[model samples]
Each structure stands twice: as structure tokens, then as C-alpha cells.
Target: MEKYIEIRGTNLFVKYLNPDSRKPTIIFLHDSLGCTKLWRDFPEKLGNATGCNYLVYDRLGYGKSDPMPTNPRPSNYLEIEADILNDLLIKLQIDSAILFGHSDGGSIALITASKYPSRIKGILCEAAHIFVEEITLRGIYEAKELYKNSNLAERLEKYHGNKVDILFNAWVETWTTSDFRNWNIEHFLHNISCPVLFIQGEADEYGTMAQVEKTVAQVKGKAEKYIIPNVGHTPHKEIPDQVLDRTIDFILQLAH
Candidate 1:
């Protein structure tokens, strides 16, 4: 089911699938420029494979959700997003959730798991960054160039519609800022007690293996890493079968 739910006073676009109250819900969080639609059928496929409920939503400034109230977002934006996710779970009465987050979404999941450990069963973070790296800045710079020269903007428009510019600029501008360079959430890592599965591509342009290594080393809970060879930033999209198989194994183990 798809609908607009008021979250933190903002109308956010949400989609729920395979609502089985008896099973844990797998919440899929998209990347910086992604939304509900951008997740495509992965949620459904995963939901069916695991026989678990799944939820996907567009963040405040992306997709069908309300636009961000302000531009040049604060440095703690991801932390705020984590708080919003916690509130969302409370409002929805979701007692158990396994977060599957990518990129920015992955960082948000880590933050949420640290701050609100009760509801989170586990976390699967793909290409999540704990701290800003020089490589990350380089990737963002390249993306900015792509947006200006290529059809990247036009392609994003198909998903974000008129709000495309705001969403794109928000990502580029915030990440490029000097203050945001020091934006790091590593302090929250020690607080995450729930089991975490860190997945990343060996060829990821935005971050290095340090992202997965440090995350695996810091988290207080049982942590594992899956480094896919020859894959870029998005491992799931690049190799769905491998990701699906591994994710299913992880979630099934958690269920038991």
C-alpha cells in the first residue's frame, strides 16, 4: 500500500508491502537522490523471499514527499533524519525493524540504530560513510560535473519531478561544504549494539574499504562485512542475486 503519511509534520510518501504483523519489517532506505520509486521492486522481491513486511519512503526533500523547509542543510542533517526515522517507527507502531540502507540512507540507519536500539533488530548498510573522506568529495565533484554536462539531471527529474533541482543541489552543496567535510558519525558507532551487516563495493568511487573496515571494527554488536569485487557504490543494484542471497541469510539468522 502506498500513501502519504505525516511524519514530523511533513507529508512523506510511503509504501508498505506484505504486511505480516507476525514478522519483522525490513525498511528500505534509499540513497541521497533516491526515493520510494527509485527502490523499484527490490523491496517486494526481498519481502517475498523472506516472507517479511517491507516499507519504503521518500525523505522530506525527495520524490513525492514534501520539499525541504530550507536549503543549505545543516551539518547534522543525517542525525536529524535518524531522529525522524525513530519517530516514524513509533508512529507506525513497528516494534521490530531490520534496516536496509544505501549511501546516505545507510548512515541514517547506523545513527538510528545507535540512538534507538530497542526497535531495530539489525542493520544492513551499503556504502555507508562514518566520516567524510577526500575520495567522497572527489566523487561529489564529479557528480556535479555530470549533472551539468550529462543527462544525470534529466534522468533524476523522471523520479523527483520538479523537486529534482532542490534535491540534487541539496546533496551536492551540503557535501561540498568545508564544515561538512568534518561531519562524522563514528562516535555513534560504539552505541550500536544490534547486529550489523556492512556491504560495500571494492570499486566504490565515493568511499574506500575503510568505511566497511572501521564500521565492522567499531560497532559494539556482531558485525560482518561483504566486499563485492568489481562493484561500484551500489552493490545491490550491481549484483542483486548475490546481495539477495547474503541478505536473506543475514535476516534469516536474525529471525532465529
Candidate 2:
């Protein structure tokens, strides 16, 4: 179930659970500096709870996947990632998918659902950013400092290995760039007609409530929001039971 699959000429580390199942697949996308291994057992637990197959993969330049070119990434990188996800779905022969994405992965999920509505059945995104915010930049700046001063890089190495620096730099440098300030994906929201659930922590350090509010207002889909009190950034990891219960209810409702 775990193997390397060539996606757009890059070998991506992919883990597929119950690939032969006829039920819709739930594709789990990790946050920046995260990989297939970082997702741990959340995918399996969710899959078992919903009786749905699940897929998890390391993006190029992360985990067991092939490295990417070391160059400045363009502002539209998330959109490019969305295109890659579409191709990956085609290569894997997945007819339908429900995306569960976190952080940067959440943004990618929104873009993918917008561009490929037919292939996407629904979306559940946590802490997804549509545009640059001062709070977001502050969080990244703080993280950059932590990476330089603390053992953050060392901890990340356990998951990303030698590719940790590249992945971390890719996330920090790209988001902190001045040109990326105007980098917004709101234009694509109206194109997303499928159901979407935007989940975020009320105490999230990286973004504010505006992120969840604007997303629910802009998306053309039947949009809902779940703002978890006292949680920060990652609700699934912080309060797995609450997230699991809410997500299960969401998926079950989608079946009707």
C-alpha cells in the first residue's frame, strides 16, 4: 500500500489504504514541512471511521520523494500543485476524492477543488489561507527564528531527512517575500461548487478569523465553518476526537 509513484516525472512517496474499495477516497494532504510519515495514523483512523479509502503522499522535495529544483518559487505555486494533484488522481485512477488538507495543503485543496470539481466530491480544510496577512507573516518570521535558534530543524529532520532545509526554506522564503503579499486565491473560490467545510482554530497563531469568514463567504459551494475554541493551528492533532466526530458527521451528510 506504500510505494513510490511517478507523478509528473517526479517520484512521489504515496500510501494508499484500501485502494480496491469502491467507496470514495479521502485524500489527506499535509502541511508545509510535513510528509506522508507526518500524517501518522489520522488517515487510517478516518478511513476506518468513515469506511472510505484514503490516500497520503509526500510532495516532491519532501520525505521519500525525489528532490525539486532549488530555485525561487513563483507566487502561483499552490495552483501548480493543484494541477499536479489532478494529474496524480488520473495516474492513480481515482474517480472521486474528498480532500482533507491542512495549512498549505488546505490552500492546495481549495485550488484543486476549484479547478477539478468533477473529480472532487468534497473538501475539509484546516487553517487554509486565501491571502497574505500580517499575522501570517509574523508567524512565519517567528518560525524562521525558531528554526535558526532552536531544535526545530532537528525535529523536522526526523521526518524530512536531508530535504528538511529545502522544504522549510521553500515554505518560509516563499510566504515571506514582498511580492507574495498580493498572492491571493479568492478568485478561484467562486469556481468551487462542491461542498466544503473550513475548519480552523480560534487561537491559530498563523491566521485570524477573517480567513474562515472570507472563505465561507466567497466559495460558491455549500460552505460551513468549525472554529474550535482554545485550539491553535492544527485542530486534528490538538483535539483529534472533536475533529474526528465533526469530520465523520460531515462525510456522512455528504453521502445523503
Candidate 3:
């Protein structure tokens, strides 16, 4: 069975797999609009495929976790997230882990690896946003319009529960912030000190291919890239089987 524990006065909904395996644990973090449930069964499939222990959880305000307060543009959102992660691991008796994060989760994973290199065995990032771009802002503006009219919000509400607005607004508002436009975390990439796999979709609408190309160019570490030909921002969800296959093979390489 899986396990869960609270951290910083919030319920962190976490699921653990392969309890008997000595392999490095994989901690999966969802995208900006994603919650644990939105990932569907990819984590479980990958866990069994790689034979490594796996964990998947919702961030505060997403999925079954507690709602987050407004104003998340902290200079230390990532720092605080990393701290909470360590606390959660300690509470659950887990030490080392490989973080697999998507979109915003991917950014968080990068932040954590840069700051707490010792705790991470590796990191796998998919469709991560490094810096803001005009395309990103425009896409977010369209999303805000969708939230006002389309059934997307209602559909997503099923995954985020009553805190749907909190999750959606946090993502849209933060990225839309004037000060956040110049935000770039590339400076911290060199400090990762661990193997990384970067995956991006050729058709990712929210972020440009240029950002991923920049990461491929700048990150001074063992990093590999796999760009899906015909997918959107959420490749893991848009094309799960292809991603699952690529991820399983890549993660297994670290086993030995």
C-alpha cells in the first residue's frame, strides 16, 4: 500500500511503490495544471516498468492536497518546496530519490537539485519552462479566456477538487506577473551535480523549443534530450506511451 504524511500544516498526498526494491526511488511531480490524478496511471506503469520505487503526489492546492494561499511569487517557492520535500521524505523514512517533474514541477525539480544536490540521484524533466517568453504569456492569456468560457475549468475541477481556482489562478497569475517575465533559473542548472533527462515536445504551445534548446546548450552536466515530434506542452499526458517507453529505458540505465 502507498503512504501519505503532512508537511508544513498541509496534507501531502503521496503514493509509494516497490517497497522492497533497493533501487533509487522516483519522485514524480505534476505540471502547473496537473494534479496526481491527472497523471492517470503513468507513474504506476513506469514504476513497474523500471522496477524502481516510485512516488507521486499533489502539490498544495492541487489534487487531494490542501489549498494554498494566494501570492506564490516567492523568491523561495522552489526553496520552500525543496525543504518540504525533505521533510516529507524524512517523515516517510525515504532518503535518496530521483525527481521526475513535468512543466512547473520540472522547474521545481531543477531548483531542488541545484540547492540540495546530495538528496537527488538524478532528475528527469519534461516540458520545463526556463524563462518567460512572449509565446508563454500569450498562451496564458488564451488560457485565462478558456477558464472564463470553456469546460476546461469544470473538467479540471474534478482533479483539483474544490480548490480548482487556487491551482489555476496560481499558475496563470504568477507567470503573468510583470516581475516574473524576466525570471530565468538557468544560472542554477550547473549546480545540479546529477544526471538529467530533458524531454520536450516539438509542438509545445506554452513554451518555445528555444528554451529547451538553451537548456541543452547551457546545462553543464550529463543531460540528454528527447523532443517528441507531434505533441503539445504536456507530452507525458499527450503521448504517455512514447514517454513511458523513453522514460523506462532512460531510468534503467542508472540502475547499474
Misplaced by over 4 Å in model 1 are none
Judging by TM-score against the true structure, name the best candidate.
Answer: 1
Give per-residue CA lDDT, model 2, range 1-256, as digits (tens). 9899988788999999874557889999888888888887888988998888999999888889998788478899989989999998998889889999999999999999999999999999999999999999999999999999999999999988888888889889899888999999999999999899999999999999998999999999899999998999999999999999999999878756
Clashing pairs in 3: none
User: Candidate 3, which ten residues in sequence have the lowest lDDT sum?
Assistant: 71-80
Candidate 1 RMSD computed on C-alpha atoms after optimal superposition onto the true structure: 0.8
Ranking by TM-score: 1, 2, 3
Q: Clashes in each model (backbone N, CA, C under 3 Å)?
A: 0, 0, 0
**Which prediction has the highest lDDT against the true structure?**
1
* Candidate 2 weakest lDDT stretch, 10 residues: 16-25
Report the lDDT tens digits of candidate 3 across residue range 16-117.
775655778899988878877788888889888888898888888778888897736564465577677777767766767888998888888888888778
TM-score of 2: 0.98
lDDT for position 146 in model 3:
96
RMSD of 3: 1.6
- Candidate 1, residues 158-218: lDDT per residue as tens digits? 8988888888888999999988988989999999999999999999999999999999999
As for TM-score, the candidate ahead, 1 or 2, is 1
